[model samples]
Target chain A: MSRLSDLGEFGLIAHLEKILPGGVSKEWSVAIGDDCAVRRSSGGRSEFLTQDLLFEGVHFLPGNSKHWETVGWKALAVNLSDIAAMGGEPVGAVIGLGLPKRAKLREVEALYRGLARAARRFSCPVVGGDTNRSRGGWTLAVTVLGETRRRPLLRSGARPGDSLWVTGELGGASLAWRAERKGKKIPAAMRRRLLLPTPRLEWGGHLAAFGEVGAAIDLSDGLAGDLGHVARASRVGFDVDLETLPRPRGFAGLCERVGVDALEAMLEGGEDYELLFTLRAGAEKAFGDYARSRGLKVARIGRARRGSGIRWFENGREIPRRFGGYRHF
Target chain B: MSRLSDLGEFGLIAHLEKILPGGVSKEWSVAIGDDCAVRRSSGGRSEFLTQDLLFEGVHFLPGNSKHWETVGWKALAVNLSDIAAMGGEPVGAVIGLGLPKRAKLREVEALYRGLARAARRFSCPVVGGDTNRSRGGWTLAVTVLGETRRRPLLRSGARPGDSLWVTGELGGASLAWRAERKGKKIPAAMRRRLLLPTPRLEWGGHLAAFGEVGAAIDLSDGLAGDLGHVARASRVGFDVDLETLPRPRGFAGLCERVGVDALEAMLEGGEDYELLFTLRAGAEKAFGDYARSRGLKVARIGRARRGSGIRWFENGREIPRRFGGYRHF
Candidate 1:
């Protein structure tokens, strides 16, 4: 029998998808392999459903290394990113929690407070959930229900001539994680970006509504890995200029202090929770204007090509792939 | 700081509900307190969403006591029961899985096969989900989306004198559990009841369509505990007769061999996945006809009263509470 380590996370998902039934209902417009599953609802709106699971040791440390509130924020934040990736507005969420029997009520209360804060911030209500005792460590599984007036964004719609764009800066989360692992203090701004990622719902909504965006995905799995998903799904190749990648504030200084490569950090850092999308060639000018009006900074860093797979370029030279984002298995 | 054991499972839920936001969306009709959250959808059908979490050591014994496929079946079956309680037809579902790094691909495949089996049986498609490696034991969280053309049933609708009815038999699950814990052989029928429970979707749909069913809930937490939920929600009391409670086939023999009280086993046995509902007095005859025609056995177990709280009686004599069902904390 093959082990899960041999298949890895994506391979396991693909294997399961083959064995599981799909499109059993006519309502399902988009099923598995997307950021969110889309169903055709009434009133010309599409209902989007997405879920994410976070474990104590796999996703975050449980004890003094992380605050319970930040842990709670991250659990819901990841699901929100999924919604944002699909260009939908979240309406409600259900949290399925599994905690150790020895967990304290005060800690659980604090965790909910953080969750509540995020819910209110995103206008997504916590509608229902189930809680159970776990003999293992903590597990938080959140499912977000959302809707969109326009067609939900997908990773398979990118055209060959489309320009790839990214919202906000990256690499801060990876730097903060490295610092935390070394017992070094993380900057307040970097820590917030790492622990409490803000899902770009407003920006994604504009992109989807404007009708010029090609494909979109969230940068939860780092630039290289997530872009690879879009490339594979869209059947196109990407030539990303490494120098054009936007770095977070003080990111270069943090990389120097932490003894990490800045370009590698920007390329392979995970958990940024920013939106990476493709736009038509001339749509970039209109998009830039709209983003500027909204006080949002978006960078055009790459272009989709006729071939397949993602390749990195620096100063007109190709950079060999050496590192990627976090792997579950 | 109060420990989770101090509040127990229900108390912890109550505490979290107080802190969590409820009904922030205009679409939410029923939130937080029911088997599923109901939302007014566009096509006049009410959408219902419910989730359940199962832990490895707390919910089942991983390798020795149960097969991986049974574990997956139980995880999805419990969520289907919630949809059945709300009298809705499941359209789609998302499963969030947390597995240890050492998990085998063959075991995972078997688990998905069980999930696929239940999905086919109920016609609820497995749409989307997230999977990650866990440092602790295995965890499965399932969220089901359902819809009903009739008004969704709630636990708050039972009026005084409404007849309490239950679909199918109980006690087999608890008996099977005890035998498994003691490493004794479980009867084939009991094992099926314990491992592969069938959700009462058709009966629940009829009850909802008939429009005479009052309050409803699934028998996941035993007769006594789940009835308490309906009583508290409806602000009515229940007088349950121990004699009328339906026992599974060969239940008496199993109880004698297991050294368990038959009454306690019938009342406190959980994970039965049966539907417990209240019917208007005269509606019982029609319900009985429908059930009989469908080859389903439903028993009128009790009636709702004017006061609150649930009480057990035996042939006009009151029986004091001896035990309740499983507690998470």
Candidate 2:
């Protein structure tokens, strides 16, 4: 007799995990709980499968062509991030789009064009889909299929003494949200970071190729929450050095001007779509060299340790905190 | 500048086909414009992928636990039918579900249970999925992955001399719709057929094993409209013998009471989920014997010929027709 609101998002997932049959099969190595389900394919490769859903009002604002296009990009980008988290290469995607009766064909086409553009960028084709008329707002459900020749990265591989690293800057999504809420126009760079996140596919694939990186996750649910998932799955904890964390240009000033806490925004902001992975201790120098060689910026922001939850420190002083990032419900 | 309503569902699909890259690859034998996208997997087998979407208030009524359960079942069932249409055995499925905030936990559990039941019945596991909260009604998008050792069937395989056959009676879905529209109580049998259709998986697999069946399509868009797809794809026409079509018990009487044309209902009502396939000339007797051994009911309802579109006849006399079946937009 309980309502969905009471269970929250993670609770609901846990409930489903209990009720449904074991998500794994003979060919599948990982299933429901992972970022992407992994299935053993031929040629020493494993396939990754992930799905994501975005609703009109819930996920995006219904507007002109640009808005629809951005929605389309995000719908596929999020699922691609799942594959990236698994250190997989793109194969293809299927989009299930639901449009209201009054939807314009041009807008719908623009959406498809946006999806096609992203597919081409990642070398993944739009293979097939289903389109239907809806009695509600527009819904875009995208499922991406990917493959990896190397062993797939997983959240459960993190261990105590592993160095935590992240790609790109954080807090861009939160800064954009705060700017919009305060009636301030978002900066062009920040807006792009917020709305058009580039999945770190190459970086993730490189991590897998290195064979020394312990575990990885995408920063979709903010650093604290997502790292918490890695911590729980790997039965470890994290100690983040606040000062070492990379920030978007003018991040602190923008947060202060918008009347938000800069450090909190960086730690708890969601949808950054950056890679948060752990490398074995002493492997940092070599990994940093590799990152620089690839022209990718990576920062060692924290370290995994023997504990239960994330512990934060600013200049070696423990900072007591609360705020577990975004929850959909 | 056209609205979606102007182009309709098929028109939108045609538009997408032109704008996107050729939905094919070195490993993919078929992609867009087929029951399932076929990818050459390992072990001399090819994989089939298909997706389907169902929206609340458009495809079903949102009510109590039973209604949610039925919706979940139909969501996966329709995708299975697509795999069945390709004459493939399902390997697994992924579901994307969007629920309104008010959706009950108990009901969602019931829905998942129903999905699990169907998955067990067909031996297709629910391997993965994404669930999100929506700003609108419930939405279910399901993608099924299947595989076949035999060559997958295609609509373009129909030849001029093929015999058209259908498994199960027609008009049940149309009758259910009519009865509901007229505020009349729908008979239990008709309602079950409409909502909980049994995909003709065994029959489709058998046809593919026979290696002589030409084209095949699931009866989701009614016989006439779906047959039109095969006709266009194979460059062959059809002459349907209306008298030979098997009707649900009391179909005509129910249609008459609801003020609907029985013939139109039988030819144009959608969601039957029956197998409509073409067989090579003079193979009916052998196929019939196989069907009898398997306890499957099938009837020869038409003949493929060298023409352009479907021509309907009643008792060898042409019956002029206008209805072209269901279009979502």
Candidate 3:
């Protein structure tokens, strides 16, 4: 709890190093002891960079019974998904934190513990950062450095004949939030599904090297919303087969409990943290085979069309998108 | 005016791009159109990096007349000082802003304009950024990147015999802040001193190439406070000659209006953004010559000692540090 200036630049940094579970690796040629950090990419590997900001209240409410560690985990997980979307492996991350002066020392430490856990899990270093006192709420800004060997997958270049696919079913996070709010005693298995998301990085990297995917995106904003992004970015439309859409097991009953259609969940409920990608029509079999070998479920949901806009088909009936996904503005 | 999510990612980004002034140059490799921005770095040239955060209430008051542009400039200025300490030239910067949802659009746009002006003046690009809604107060976090060819300076390199020196005068910001509060008008030149901080980046960079300075720091946290940082970091003590400290021509008169000690103001008031450094005793003449030629006044304010702790001497009489400095927490 020392004042930033009083601790002095060096003392402040040393204090931060002590709090970290383990130190950054030797890849950091110029680390915390210097004016700035310096690290060379693993001998000519291209650098992959992405940043995310988590503002208190907007990202998470302080009163939520959900633990801070989980918040830390999901924050990093979501950004990692962005790198995964690029078919890259995470190397390290720098965190910039703004906390109100009144914030508890214990809470701050816990937040870093969560950050450290995520770093260790992803095998990325919690490299360097800035910790400042805020006038109001806490804010976390993270910039991740990732590495790619083959090539980076971008959101452009989807062909009209390419097939679009998604990994895992969506809507679990929305349902989890509701359940948490209602204090529903859901089973540990489903609760974990809602809380801890799996980043499809490994699958995406292999898909990139396999030369099968033309464009890729992560389902951070649900299928309908993020698919729209890829389609727009690629200047193509999509025709999704409703019947082909994957559903969560026992999803129908869960939809009934919520008084809504299960299709809505699959299309628009976000925080899935799953990868959505497009592949050449002829590459589906091999792609599917590779995914299954990795124990991941690949759902062929739609096809890229020459036109703009998305349409859904089910049992010979075509339907329009009732809901796309969440928006922040 | 737009629910951020409603704006959608592309639409929101376009809005930002349109509102922000066009880039001064092509330093940004990927710019705003990609999944992540790519930049020129040390692989090309040694890069300087620093991130700073300013929270509402702590840094500024609600309904304060200070425009968002000032806040934006201040954020960039503070980080610029860090790079300046390392004697690096500004290249580009990224701003991650979090605002209370209720903030006006004009305020946000002004913030960008302020950022744009700073970028143009410093010859740094507004490469990229992240924006989100804060649960409560508005927060502005800026990460600045700079470049240098010389060995980066650090706070731990000062030797016991090194003479301590400071560029320009200190404590002008505290005087300006006090003047603004008392409803007293300061002269336009003095006002500019408070509103626009002069970053000694080029000066520091030149100093670094000369390679005579032992250790260095920027005076963003007032002189005593920031000097204390260097003292502790170097594990050495310093004695400051207060009589040699340059006084802003207009500052001595403010003691009466603000009911504060001018000396104390010079000691603890911050945001001067001046470089404070230590150099080997024999290099004093060269340092003085260089400083004089550049129209920059340099003074031999102290000496680094074998032990730790900072002491101030006025008329060669040792004086106690009445106050440390302004600290956020």
Name the 10 consecutive residues with the lowest summed lDDT in model 1 chain B.
B57-66
TM-score of chain A of each: 0.96, 0.97, 0.83
Candidate 1 docking band = medium
Q: Name the top TM-score candidate.
A: 1
Q: List model 1 lDDT by residue over A300-325, tens digit each.
A: 99999999988888877998865576
What DockQ class does candidate 2 belong to? medium
Clashes (backbone N, CA, C under 3 Å), per candidate, total 0, 0, 10
Candidate 3 residue-wise lDDT, B1-329, digit = tens: 34434543334334434422231124333233311222344345544446666678767655533567777667777778878887788755656777675666556655666666676677655544566667768777777656676766677779899999888877677788777888887776666667777678778877787789988888877888788778876899998888888877757777666776888778888878888999987998887888778776667788999999888888889976555856554
Report the lDDT tens digits of candidate 1 across residue range B1-329: 67788888888888898888765368898888899999888778899999988887778666632388888777888888888888899989999988886677777888898898888888988999999888888788899999988899899989998999999997888788888777777689988998898888887887787788999999998888888899999999999988888887777887888777887667787888898999987888888887788776789999999998888888989888655767877
For model 1, the superposed segments whose C-alpha errors exceed 4 Å read A23-25, A64-66, A321-323, B64-66, B183-186
lDDT of each: 0.86, 0.85, 0.68
The digit string of per-residue lDDT tens for model 2 on A56-173 reads 8888878899877887787888889989998999888888889987788888877887787788788778889899988889888888888899999999999999999998899898
Interface RMSD of each: 1.4, 1.2, 18.2
Shares of reference contacts reproduced by the candidates, in order, are 0.85, 0.71, 0.25
Residue B254 lDDT in candidate 1 = 78
The model with the greater lDDT, 2 or 3, is 2
DockQ for all models: 0.76, 0.71, 0.13
